[model samples]
Each structure stands twice: as structure tokens, then as C-alpha cells.
Target: MRAAPARRGRDGADTRARIEAVALELFAQKGVAGTSVRDIALGVGVSEGALYRHFPSKEKLSRELFLTRYATLAAEICAIDAAERELERKLRAVVGLACALFDAEPALFAYLLIHQHEHLGLVPEAPEANVVEAVAQMLRGAGVPPGRVTLASAMALGCVVQPAVFALYGRIKGPLAAQADDIAAAVMVVVEGQARG
Candidate 1:
């Protein structure tokens, strides 16, 4: 007798979620520029057609993945902005939150960090809803000068996020969360320096 035909996605299975998970892993490991739709489909244990049913193209897949990851981080930034009132304290909270997120979802963190420059244009509403904009807006709202907002944001994010990349490469010794204080301190130095100008 012939075996049962293979199933498409089940009612609750949501192959789309699997597609995103596998795509994120491949993108995190190999970079979006290196990973293809075929690779993601293979990793998800689905045919290319199945994957395409979920995502029309590799570029669409990459942008959607980036959007999800960035949104998660953006939500955290929104919380930090709402909770903290001072620039220095808010920055410390941001770094601490970054470290926590890095520890919890390093791949997502790394994926966004790794691909932001290339995929920023691909993702819609990126500039207005991004981390830089969040930080800059926080600063602007706190009476910080417009010119200083950009520099302070750059300094804050770079200080916190660079070490996350280092940790990913094993260049850093401990979990990203463990370096929160150091990261926060370094960010404060930059923010303070920029504010003094």
C-alpha cells in the first residue's frame, strides 16, 4: 500500500513561524547576504514552494525577520524611555536592557546588529521607529540640544552593542548581561562628553 501523502502546514502548525526561526538562524550564522530562500526552506524542513507561500522572496523574508527583531528591541527601548527621566540614568537603563536582551536573544540581537546598515532601507518605517530615533527622541524630549541628540545616541548604542558583537565572537569572556555595568559606564562617559559640548 502507498504511504500517506505528506502534510502541508497543519491548522495550528504555522509553517511561517518555522520559516522565520530557521531563516533567523541561517541569517545569524551566515548573514542575510549569504543565506538564500532555498537555504531557509531547507533549514525549515519544507520545500521552496512551501516557504514561498509564506514569504514571497528572500528579500522579503530578510526584511520581515529584521522587523520582528527590531520591534522587540524597540519595545524595550520604549519602556526604558517611559521609565527613566534623566539622560544619564536613562542611558544606563538602556545599556542594561540591551545586555539583558543580548543574553536572552543573542541571535536576534546579533542579526539586527549585523544587518541594520544593509536592511534598514528595506524595512519600512525604520528611521522613525528605530533605536537611534528612540534615544534621540528621549534626549530631545529631555531638553537636550538637537545637535547633541544624534551624537549621544550614537555613543550610547555603540558602547552597549559593540561588546555584544565581541561576546558573540568569544572575544568577551562573560555573558552580555554580566557586562552591563561596564557598558553603562562607558556609555555615560560618551553621553556626558557629548553633552558638555
Candidate 2:
């Protein structure tokens, strides 16, 4: 009956969610290239065939997971760019958000950070889904020279990202959010192009 179908749908959705969660954990622990569909299926407590009922292949699942999370972060960064007008304030907001996310969900954040290169080319071409473009757009709006925008954006993002990387490797102690203000200031230096020999 209809009730039986509804229950199956709920179970199917739960199974899919479990698959995604397990896949992300494995992907974080082992690089995407290192993780296998069997690994994900085993972790999720589902048969390999059942996993395929949700994702056709491991590559598709990895791409889907990467794009989904990356787009969410990109959208958030775009929203921050849209809301803040001042350059320093905008930098602080964006940096703070990145650090907070790293602290809140280290596995998800690490997955995104480490696997970005593998998946960036697959990202859809949309301003709201391109974090780099969003940061560049913010820099341009803040009066950073057109010629400098691209480099400045990379440098600015690095000011936040590198710390998270260091924290990930245990070289840095404590939550990244604690360093947000300093990171923001460092990003400002990049944006301003404060020359130092």
C-alpha cells in the first residue's frame, strides 16, 4: 500500500544519507583516490549493490559530495561578500567563516580542502558556486587594482587556509577560529600589497 511505499522511501533516504556520511569520513581519512566503493559500503553497513542504488560509482559519489559541499561554501562566501561593504570587515567575515567551518566540521573541511584540486574543474560555472571568483569580486569592489585582483584573492584566501592546513597537521594548536582576526589582518596586507623585502 501507500504506507509501505512511504516507509521504503524513508528507509532509502536514510540509507543514502548514511552512505554519504561514511563516504565523507573515508574520503577525509584516505584521499578520494584511496577510497573505494567497497570501503564506503562496508562503513555504511550496506551491500555494495545497495550503495550503487544510490550512487552509480565511487567517482560519481566523490564528485557529487565535493561539488555539493564546495557549492555550499561558495554560496556562503558570496553571501558574506554581498553583505559586507568594507574591505577589512569583509575579509574578517570570510576568514572567520572559513575558520569556524574548519573547527566545526574538520572532516568535511579537510575533505574539501585536500580534494579541491581534484574536483574544482568539475565545479559548475556560476558566480555563486565559485569561492575564488567571489573573493576576487570582493577585492575588485573594495578598490583593489584589476591587475592585482586574482593574485590578491589567492593570497587572501591563503592567509586563512594555510593556518587551517597547519592546524590539520597539528603544527598549530587549538581551533582555527581563535586565529581569525590575525588571519583577517594578514589578508588585508595581501589585499593592500604591502611590499616587503
Candidate 3:
């Protein structure tokens, strides 16, 4: 028996998403500079022309993919109402969220870290800054001094995120799950210090 035909709009979106996913996987595995549009098209089971129809150029596609992921993360982070939580709780939540995201996409995390310098301009500076700002705001709301908030945020990024990034990139050898938890705990200490002082 023949299968039903795909509906236009939803099927089109699904196909695009599949292409993007395959492209991201290839790029992560081979490095964006090493991967080709033909490679992405082959992985997605589509013609090169079709890939071009969806993404004009490989660089443009890469930028769009990164931006799309970052936007989704930013939205998730923004959705957390830090105003309702204590500073320590809010900071913990942020670290937890980051860990969860990294766990869900370790390859993507590795790719980002590997290419961070090359794509520094494409990085969503605002989204990251927003996360720091949210932490600072939460600390202020909890009656912590502004100076402490900045220091806490810096420490959290350095201790939690930097190490997690390294872990994802395989620069350090260990279980990522355990490392993520430890990083979150370390970040919480910094937050707690800010809350108490």
C-alpha cells in the first residue's frame, strides 16, 4: 500500500527542521569550516538545490542555526521569574537550566566551544548578558549589594559555565552529569555568599 501524502505546511516545516538537525550534527562532528553544503544535503537526503532553497549559503545557515538555538534558550531563561525566588534559588535554577540544555545537546555544546573564537561575533551577547542581568536583578531584589551581585555572576559564569564548556569539549575527562552537578553546586556557593553578605 502507498503512504499518505505529506501535508504542505507542517510537512514542509518538519523537513526544514530535519535538514537543520542533520546540518547541525554534521557541522558539530566535522567542524563548520570542514563541512560542506553537499554534505548537509546528503545527510538530509535532499538535493543540493533544495538545500540552497532553504538556506542560501552555508555560513548564513550556520548563523541562523546558532541564533535559533540561542533564542530558544534565551526565551526559556527569560521565562523563569527570578523576581519570585531568592538569589540563591534563582542562580541555582539558571545553572540547572544551562546544565540541562548542555546535556540535551552535548555535541552542539562542544561545537560552540570549539568554534567560539571563530564565531564570537555571532554569539548572542544579549541573551548571555540578559542572564547575568537577571541574576543581578534577583540579587538586588533580595537586598544584596550591587557589587556582590556582579562578583557572584562573574564567579558563576567562570566556575559553572566555563568548566562545563570545557567538559563538553572533552578538554577535561570525566562524567558530564557529575561535573554539571558539581558546577551548579559551586555556583550556588557564590550566590549564597552574595545573599549573606
Better of 2 and 3 by TM-score: 2
| 92: Cα error in model 1, Å | 2.7
Best-to-worst ranking by TM-score:
2, 1, 3
Q: If both were scored by TM-score, which would come out higher, candidate 1 or candidate 2?
A: 2
Candidates 1 and 3 compared: the better one by TM-score is 1
Q: Write the per-residue lDDT of candidate 1 for residues 164-196, one digit (tens) a residue.
A: 888999999777888888888888787677667
RMSD of each: 4.5, 2.3, 4.0
Cα-based lDDT for every prediction: 0.78, 0.87, 0.69
Model 2 spans > 4 angstroms off = 194-197
What's the candidate order when arranged by decreasing lDDT?
2, 1, 3
Residue 179 displacement (Å), model 1: 0.5
Candidate 3, poorest ten consecutive residues by summed lDDT = 123-132
- Model 2 C-alpha lDDT per residue in residues 80-118, reported as the tens digit of each score: 888887778888899989999999989888999999999
Give each model's clash number. 0, 0, 0
Q: Which stretches of candidate 1 lie over 4 Å from their true place?
A: 1-13, 122-128
Cα RMSD (Å) between model 2 and the true structure? 2.3
Predicted candidate 3 versus true structure: per-residue lDDT over 85-133, tens digit per residue: 5545665666677776677887666655566556556554564334455
